[model samples]
Target: MAPLRIQPMPTYMDIHEIPGGITADEVAKAHAHDAAVEGKYGVHYHKYWVNERAGKIFCLCEAPNAEAAMQVHREAHGQTAEKIIQVEPDVADLFLGGSEVNSAGAVLLPGGAADARDPGIRTVLFTDIVESTLLTQTLGDDAAMELLQIHDSVVRDALKALNGREVKHTGDGIMASFVSAAAAVRCAAQIQRGLAQRAGEQSNHPVRVRIGGAAGEPVEHGNDIFGSTVQLAARLCSHAEPEQIVVSSVVADLCIGKGLMFRPLGEVSLKGFDRPVHAHSVEWSA
Candidate 1:
């Protein structure tokens, strides 16, 4: 007989969009109501984020399914989420960070115990050295290491300036997360321009990098960020040409009116994704 497979409870992040704006106190009350009724549907409401200025509320929960999670909200406070996406616990934690909550169940900023709230959204960026293996073969290990060092320094500098957190070093490049999509876009442009300047200074072993970015809420899969957002960012990076920056439509839309120039690439097929994803190329050169 075949062995039975047990399905794990799925984690979900739900977004509530309030037009004018919402207060932390109001969200706290709604969360209390959710907690009161979640048990009935076997849903566990973990933590929530309130962006008063953005008029957005994000709730993290685990339930049998998205519908079950939404049912809890309907029963609890009649505040249904505008959208809900299934996420992995670890990925959600990576982007959302520590789970410290106040007395009202709202998540606080990593170290800020005072009334500040985390918005629960992040823009993930990936940078890859174009033809890294070929470069290593042509330049040998020592020279390749030097090129990598240059890439590291330039990317780190831009990250520091833009308030981006380096998630991990990708050997040939870096992976970072930012609170603002515009900042992420700006950082990518800076990295490209910096590399171009460096190439001009050094004729031999010119380093060219490809960058990609995508914006979304926290979703986890494994120890690293293996969510769709991260995947999209990585795929876009791979799709980019040397010295080019590619980003998802979501990232481009978020940067609207932010003075960033992007040429739409229409929809492009990517690996591991069922449908084609809309992409844009950032014009980062002078």
Candidate 2:
């Protein structure tokens, strides 16, 4: 089955504390813009309530990941949330229980059942050098080593600028995680552009990197994250062409207003996934 046929899941939820208070008109306006902004990135948002006395608002959204939800909030009104959290797909149904079952098994109703799972979301990024073996053969060990160092410098600079954490080195590449999808996408584009610039600056080894991004609930164990999301991101990197940035449908949806453009590649078979994944190629130049 194609991913488009599957039910959409609510993966992120956040509570914004409006210390100054908010109005119905403001909520209505935000919701109207959100409907358009988030749909491009592949999510849905509904304003639940406005606590006038406490000056708070609760919002529920179905997003590919936490970054997408946060992006919508940030670009919509500059009201970037203080904290955004991941909602377990199963647990989402617990709060929205009324009649329609949320992606989570729980129904939406009064005194809704509480979900036991933890909530938080992250965007995982993976990148690798293209044809390293061939490059090494042509450039020799000493030249290849220097090229590797250049790659490290460029990527490390991007990580620092975007506030991303380098999880580990995957020999010819690296795996990193970000709190924001916007940041991750921005970092990936910068890395590509940076590498292109370096290729022109140095005449020795012109290296191109392939990048893949996916957002989801990632379980952190030590320095590494082990989950379907991580695996999915890694698979995407492997499938990408040199200097190309590939992303899942979730990533594409979350990145709608972030200045990057995506060209749809349609639903394609990815390793391990039972259904075809909807993938996109980031059009960094345009």
Q: lDDT for each of the candidates?
A: 0.86, 0.71
Off by over 4 Å in 2: 1-119, 219-226
Clashing pairs in 2: 41-253, 86-120, 96-108, 97-107, 97-108, 97-109, 98-108, 98-109
How does candidate 1 fare on TM-score? Answer: 0.71
Candidate 2 lDDT score at position 12: 58
lDDT tens per residue, model 1, 144-164 = 999999999999999989878
RMSD of each: 6.2, 16.6
Among these predictions, the greatest TM-score belongs to 1
Q: Tell me the tens digit of each residue's lDDT in model 2 across 43-123.
A: 777534444444454466788787888888777776776555665544333222223323332223222255221223557
TM-score of each predicted structure versus truth: 0.71, 0.57
User: How big is the positional error of residue 109 in model 2, measured in Å on the Cα after superposition?
Assistant: 28
Q: Please give the clash total of every predicted structure, in order.
A: 2, 8
